[model samples]
Target: MSGHAAFAVTVDLAVFTIRDGIFSVLLVERGTEPFAGSWALPGGFVEADEDAETAAWRELREETGVERFEGHLEQLRTYSAPDRDPRMRVVSVAHVAFAPDLPAPAPGSDAANARWWAVEDLLDGGPDAPPLAFDHATILADARERIRAKLEYTTLAREFVAEPFTLPELRRVYAAVWGSPPDLGNFRRKVLGTDGFVVPTDTHGVSASGGRPALLYRRGEATDIQPPMLRTAGEDD
Candidate 1:
């Protein structure tokens, strides 16, 4: 078996979901050697001839058994730390995806037990996550940075909101992620000015419902957020 060293690429995904207005992620505990018994992002070595993104999507399906998920996906970067893998030198292209709604995750394939852990609770390792196996801590930190960037200059926040939402409702999404709320008047005007950011409705909640009726709005087709919703960085919070 001389010169039989295996050559491979690995793909790890940070699949995020928001439900009940809190952020969460999907993770699995490895059941095999080479980091077995330790938690890691849902992932595996890319099969031969598989493209990076394709391998990532396939890994998501195999490990999580999820048929459909709609939201943005992006390449978060790669982990090539020389000492990243103990058995062999390996490189992993990482990814981060957002899910509009929460779905229960179950163990599959090489995972010992699959689960969805809340964002705040997940990192703390209390009833959700434990320090992940491999260099997953670096992977997770990378994913979080990308999502933070996605929050600005894009409509990514709406994915967490229901079909219909008011400015105040949407504002909370920003506040939740930014740790501090943005200026309401500035935020409202910023969104309204951006084409395809939100669409108007002829039939409002009809402001005279014997209460202060809220205005109606839905997701805009435009992906670009004009004036890019500014925010303080996560660490600044």
Candidate 2:
């Protein structure tokens, strides 16, 4: 085992949510060295006795203080570039998590601050975009694409809304992720036609603008869309 290199393992999370129709991700300002003061995905080194997923959840709770989450959480991929971490050889197991509009986060001891940033603003290469620490920008971009693709053929969209939600609420989740809204009529038909995608309830949701109340629904038993709700160009207009 002579001359064998030792590496550290970490877990990075791309925790996403839709707030006021804008898709956002949780980021923290690193308080320590290597990227001090830079914003990065909320994560940290994996513990010696825990798995990657457990570390991901732990980091999420510690960095963001999100204890009650009822949404999707899954492993995205791994990053093991030799130069990824300037300090030493490090490999990261990335995870993608989705939740409904989450509350403001309290930064943990390792972070200077924590807040939600619009995913578009971070990836748009604008002057206002804060530079991400390490390789988080790449991990976030990949996670965004994964959510967008999954929304096309899965009930993953439901993870963005609370139960007993209206169709409009669900539609907005798609709009937030896809960067545009789907056609109202087409979206309704597709969702209703796709059995088990949603279960209608007798109650209706009150419109804030005094419009007619909309029917309420909850996520159903199905996980896959039958024909798949494919996004099309100019469908929003």
Candidate 3:
């Protein structure tokens, strides 16, 4: 087999969370070239005899030391830039995972250290911090767009939220993405009217509003978010 015909496979990860109302992603500081000292998603070369997605899962655990990958995990895209890795022609299989919270984020393997960076911080990251390795900037961008879109169409937003959430709490998730307050009446109608979107768990009921501690609800198994929660325009300002 010709050596030139063989290709290198690398896996990059996008681990995201929302803290204090700001969306954030996990990143590591690279020690080696091809963008050394710069923050990049946790990932590495695929182990020999390992499958691509398997490699992604393993690399994610090794690099992030997370307990599990049971939540929403999906392949974001493949990056095959010839110069992605200066030492060889590397192809990266990128993946993204959404976690609700964290205990800690310590850098593992090639990274000097790992930390959760506020998406706003990164979005506002100036040219001075350090350039990202490979096309990680693009990878993170893709993950974010998917997250935003999915939160609208699926009951997926619940995964990021806690159970028995106050209507106000649930509304906040929408405000985070849409950046606007939803009409109280319309928003409530859409969410409650939608079958399987949420199930009222409290037997008697309590209102979220101080009025009566409105009905407490839990996440329902229904996967589809019917009558989709459409927000008013000017949603990303």
Which residue ranges in model 1 land beyond 4 Å of their true spot? 1-7, 124-129, 204-211, 233-237
Write model 3 residue lDDT over 124-188, tens digit each, in one string: 57454455677788888788777777666677767666777666777777666544567777777
Off by over 4 Å in 2: 202-214, 233-237
Off by over 4 Å in 3: 1-5, 124-130, 177-186, 203-212, 230-237
Query: Candidate 1 lDDT (Cα, whole model)?
Result: 0.77
TM-score of each: 0.85, 0.88, 0.83
Q: Which candidate is the best by lDDT?
A: 2
Q: For model 2, what is the C-alpha lDDT against the true structure?
A: 0.88
lDDT of 1 by residue, 19-106 (tens): 6666777888888988888878998888888988888888877777765566788888888887788878788999898867657876
In order, the Cα lDDT scores of the candidates are 0.77, 0.88, 0.73
The candidate that wins on TM-score is 2
TM-score of 1: 0.85
Clashes of each: 0, 0, 6
Q: What's model 3's lDDT at 36?
A: 78
Q: Model 2: per-residue lDDT, tens digit, 1-237?
A: 779899999999998988878899999999999999999998889999999988888888887787747788889999999999999999999999888768899998688899999999999776678999999999999999988878888888887788889999999899989888877777887799888999999999988999899999999999987566778833423
